[model samples]
Target chain A: MPDTGLLLYGGAFGLILIGIAGIVLSAHLVRIIFAVALLEAGANLLLLLATWHQGAAAPIIVAGRVPDLMADPVPQALVLTAIVIGVGILALALSLALRVQRAYGTLDMHEVRRHMEQDIADEAGIDMPSSSHAPAAVQTARQESGA
Target chain B: MQRLSSALFLLGLGLLIAAIFRGMEFGTVAPIVGQAINSAAAEQVGAANFVTAVVLGYRGFDTLLELTILFTAATAGGMVLGKRSPTAKRDPDAGFILQAGADLLFPLLVIVGLYIILHGHLTPGGGFQGGVILASAFFVPILARPGTRMSHTAVSTIEGLAGASFIFIGLLAMFGGEAFLTPLMGQGELGALLSAGSLPVLYLAVGLKVGSELAGLLAQLSESEAVD
Candidate 1:
């Protein structure tokens, strides 16, 4: 059998790889977002596992048990920071997807792109807005395109 | 062909996991953890909870950044979802038992969340875990009763207060001439419910802040103006 610490790392890394595969293969935007989130969490867990060894207890200060704090606290701090960032990223992605759904009337990624290309063709004069705030532009363009 | 590719993917994943375990040196690092925690970590940081020591003392700047990350997420999400979403159309049908049970369970969950946050230094759980619990508690009502109304304004108010209190606590620590998150050393009985200085208080504020913010975000997402 493999060493326990490396085993955990392996497990985490495998989960991450699976998550990435899901992101690539899944067509649904929400599923992709979830896949990305899973991958990120797995990465954080793997980083944490690298700092920890077997038989190491949680680094808490207990009376009469002034055991050496063997585990790396660096990973804990990093994971906490990552968790917050992950939450932010997920929320933003969901909100954007929601906006996309509202504007294009369907979440099929290709369909939305096609709609935009049509808009660009019709409007020929003005360059398209950046993707982040495309809805505002699409709303205006749709009024003119009327197709 | 698709099945073959999927089979290959799974096999590759298995091999990768096997490799990580095979390569790691697990036991050699044990002594290092002991040394870091027992003498060097404890004395250098004058706090009882070692995790707190790590979080508030050693990597306090990281904690500050984490808080800002949450703030940024809320702001970005709000901007995308809009500050105010239309109220959702009421479902108008709620089971009596679910409504009654949720009404009772809500306060209980809030209380438990508060208790966990306050006693974090003494107990197993801490602010983040407790915060999620509190959010779930609030979520019960929305699950059972579609007609139930949650005021975004009220949620925002609660969130603001909780956030301010967290900052205020940090300021208190700075004013006392310690580092940004230095636990305000108190003579309270160690291992008691209310010992360990400002750690418990900080945890409480964090729990409340996270819980309210998450709840507000959820309420905002599902909220659409109740269509006539």
Candidate 2:
């Protein structure tokens, strides 16, 4: 059986891998946001594990008794700060996603990207580059125009 | 082809992480500062929880900046969400069970949150953890009754005052010829509630600031008009 350290490390890394995979593979904006959160959580865990000791107690003094081996307080403090920041970022991301959904009427990543590109092109007063996958009629019309 | 490339990328990332993990020497790195703090924190900061001491004492600036970050994010989120349309329909009240549960949970959560915040220096819980519970205390009611709006004025007022008081307390320490955020007042008895000097006051400010900011942000998110 793997040691507890190995298991804990594995879980953290696993969360990071899954989060990255979700971000890369998922096509929904909300899923991507959630993946980002997962990645943040994994990173926080990894940070806390950086100063891990085998038999360390929490870094707290109880009733004038100090433990022989106490966990590092710095990383725990840092992780606490990081977690709050993560929640703030997540809330902002969700709010942004809500706004995007309101503006474009869809949450599908591809559809949103397409709409964004079209909006940019329109704003720039330039025609969008025609895709090879354009409808046959549209392609024929483009060929006939030759402009 | 895209999927294949994505899979290859992920596999490479996993291998890289695993390699780094294996290379790291766990349980061996000397925590020099941590050990020093462990020994000296009781006399210096007088907080039973060394983590709280480190958070609100040694690294108070970092905590302050973190609060600023939270404030910035909440403000930007609120701006992006904008105001709800006057005629936009609100979600109907939740079922009987949820309404009852939310009501039942409110006072209990507030008490627990305050307890955590008050005992932050003595135990594991602190401003951020307790603040989240306090936020939920307000947010739960909004979840149950969408028609009832939180008083944004009250939330913003609490948030502003709490944040100001945090900085004000830090400045107070500076007035006494100490560095910014140096814990003032004599370090009282270790492991006592009234000990830790200004740390608890700072944490009280932190908890209230975080609680109000989060509760307001959540209310804004929930009250926004639904996408058709």
Candidate 3:
């Protein structure tokens, strides 16, 4: 039989890689958030996996019989807290995504970025009323590109 | 091109992780610290559940910080998503059968959640899990009748009191005991309902705090207007 440790490690890494791929390749903000959740789940899995031992009983103490092999309590505690924290973070991210979608009228990252850029240019143009408010470095780069 | 690059990136990352994990064996080796904890857990804490002891007894400080993080997220989510525009459409109430079922099950869930929280010292379930369960109990009714509004002030008050009680218990322990969060009162017989002094109380506070916070988050998310 394959070692459970190696299998768990592989699964965790696979989840993380898949999530990263989803984040990088997907344009939708919701998909990105889902990917982030997947990343967290992978991390949590890895943490729990670190504590697993063959023939181990759960950390619970039985009445008369002494526990022979007990899994690590510290990592279990850490992972338990981490799982809740991850959910809270995921909720916050979803809220931010909701607000962003409302303001920009789009969930696509590219579309949102374009809208943001246009808004920034409009605001800067209004504020300056003369030369564009583009940063000196960016202006120089744009000029070089045009030339 | 994007797909190819992403695949390449993932492949490299996977290789790196595999290399890092290659030498490790699964479940074959017992942790040094775990051995000590298991031995001491039964004797010192008198809590049947070792994880609960660690969470609410040994490393209680971390649990406090966890509560703070959860509270902050709930507050932030509410702040960002609370305001409803005039043009937003309300979701209709659920069907009669679903609503009836939700109504019947809500109290039962709350009772179960409380039982879990109260028995945390003796069992596998703890404050965080019970609190989430409690929050889900509240969520059922909200789902049943979308138009039914929960009192924001009441929910916040429940959250505030629960959180304050948690801190108050910890501070009380600090004053009475040698260090902060040192369990006050003496440990009773193991596996008894009244055993594991202060652990159950702290778990109760955590359960309430988490329950209210998550319920508020759900309400905020459900009632808020979506992007057009």
* Most DockQ-accurate candidate: 2
Candidate 1 clashes: the total is: 13
Which docking band does candidate 2 fall into?
A: medium
Candidate 1, A22-133: lDDT as tens digits: 7656657788898999899888887677667666666665563655334555566567657766876887899888877777777765467767776886788655554455
Q: Which residue pairs clash in candidate 2?
A: none
Q: All predictions: root-mean-square deviation over Cα?
A: 6.6, 3.7, 4.1
Which of the numbered candidates is closest to the native, going by highest TM-score? 2
Best by lDDT: 2
- Ranking 1 against 3 by TM-score, winner: 3
Q: Write the per-residue lDDT of candidate 1 for residues B44-103, one digit (tens) a residue.
A: 654455665566566666666676778778777877877444443455657899789989
Docking class of 1: acceptable
Assess each prediction's global lDDT (C-alpha) against the native: 0.69, 0.92, 0.85
Candidate 3 lDDT over A34-144, as tens digits, reads 999998889888888887887788888767467788889889999999999988998999999888877887888867875776688797775322237855655564456
Ten consecutive residues with minimal summed lDDT in candidate 2 chain B? B219-228
lDDT of 3 by residue, B107-217 (tens): 999999999999998878989999999999999999999988888898999999988998898899778756778786778999899988888988999999999899989
Looking at candidate 1 chain A, the ten consecutive residues that score lowest on lDDT are A64-73
A80 Cα displacement, candidate 1 (Å): 3.7
Badly placed stretches (over 4 Å) of model 3 are A126-147, B1-3, B226-228
Q: What DockQ would candidate 2 receive versus the native complex? A: 0.59
